[model samples]
Target: MFRKEYTRIESSTQHSSVNEFVVINIPEEDVEPKQIILDPDDQPMWESAKIVAPTPNSAIIQLDVDDNFVINSTHLKMILENKFDGYLRADPHDHIREFLAICDMFKYGEMHSEVVKLLIFPFFLCDKAKTWFNELNEESIISWEQMRRAFINRFFPPSLFNRLLLEIRNFSQNICESLTEDWLRLKNMLQKCHGHSLAKGVIIQIF
Candidate 1:
């Protein structure tokens, strides 16, 4: 009976060791959690994750929902720590352009859904724009590209784009402007009109 009890106790110990709970020690300060992205060349790409357990020299992270992993703490970086509010406030009417630039910065960061959630919140969007974003189906915006297209369609209406094109066509240099200054001004207008790839000959003719 003693031997049997010892065997059972040993088995329980082994079982507990297999599924041990690890405690994450995040700092008391309002530090944003560090985001982790797997190596691009790695097979079976891992989802972006945030450090939940800040153990010394290492971190415990949860990938998506159930996959918990251990990684060196140094591997993570804080990209969104200071940029979110500045970018949101930079262009009240042109959210799409700012959103695209943000997406580019965090492309491989693996925080697409988290970033999108922040963007759609009332605090980030303007009063008039909030209603339109609120009505969107959350599940449909799984990727950054999908989110980008939605913003573009809503903000950049067909009439607005047409007006911009007309402005480009009717644009002319100001009186007393130097040749170089005029050329630069025309190029700037072309870019704003979304003619980034307009031919040099067309630009010359406009000049």
Candidate 2:
């Protein structure tokens, strides 16, 4: 019942080669449905991807990698069917749930009290990070704070990080209101940190 309205099965055509590239759309407000091109290098991982939809009746999956049926589309409906089948096969609902659950976990970090134990630490995977870690005796320990800082300063726009913060906030104010007790606590924490910038200079590697 979670995210009943935010998930849908997808439909679309796909490349026929084992190593073909495939891209799919993501439907959500304030977020452009970007197509993710998956190459053969990621085919194995793609097999495990979960699908999600923006509405209860919508299917975000075009094909189910696990399905035994093989298809080569010759008509518009067939192509659409394959596309939809792929998305259905991906089972994005699971991913949506995972996304929402993570939001809940980070949102109510205070309630958990053992926040440090639950944090996804960051260890730099770059040259500058190598030198920085060398100065820190290569301990390789880091924190979410470090990840946020590196991402904001060295990587993509702060918006990327901010989007995560916003997701948590949206969950707290609009989504959390409908959630149960455990979810409610998580939402509270999300609301508190939704707009705050992360701290800096700590490295804790996440496995």
Candidate 3:
């Protein structure tokens, strides 16, 4: 039989070599989390900062308008005459279409059509619409398409868009209404929806 031997390990705390030792007291610090304050000027591009901060020199929209390119006062007057005041009954899509129709009549001297639209669009807003336009982020709108899309998205939200779409999808002709009247009504609904993806064949089939 082989003899087994066991080796015991001693704890360093129980068998400390040096009898002398120093315990320097370290005071525990009561640290509090720092509250960071951000200046509005530091966050110029932030939407909330833009809204609350005063920016007198900054324009909400940045246009590619040349300093020398001046719009005719008469044209502006004409546009302002038919200003769209955002109200309960006002259809944003109809307003935009009407505005475009009016703008089509004028040709500014050497200025791009897009520039003309951008310059004249602001004059076309009044009352609630004008207020909404004024509240846009500084230099947010750069192009006519951007302005148009933003305008439509703001005024004609997804809820209104879906309602219009549903109306088209479930269109019903009144029992006593003439076919011509019903057709005109359906056409008007289509116009309001603006970008409904229903095929022409399906639309004719709906009729």
RMSD of each: 20.2, 27.8, 19.0
Q: Estimate each model's TM-score.
A: 0.45, 0.17, 0.64
Q: For residue 17, give model 1's deviation from the true position in Å.
A: 61
lDDT of 3 by residue, 1-207 (tens): 222222222211222222232112222345332222233333335443435656543234556667788777877888888888888578887888888887777776545788888878988999998888887877777787888888888888889889999989899999999999999999998988878888999899888
| Residue 126 lDDT in candidate 1 | 43
Judged by lDDT, which candidate is best? Answer: 3
- Please report, as a residue range, the 10-residue window in candidate 2 with the lowest summed lDDT: 198-207
List, in order, the clash count of every candidate structure. 1, 37, 0
How do these models rank on TM-score, best leading?
3, 1, 2
Error of 3 at 89 (Å): 2.7
Preferred candidate (lDDT higher): 2 or 3: 3
What's the lDDT for residue 205 in model 1? Answer: 73
Write the residue-wise lDDT of candidate 1 on 1-207 in tens digits: 111111111111111121232122223345543222222233232333445674332011122432342322221222232122323223323444554444455433454444433333333454545556656754455544555556656665566668767777787878899988987887766665553455778667767
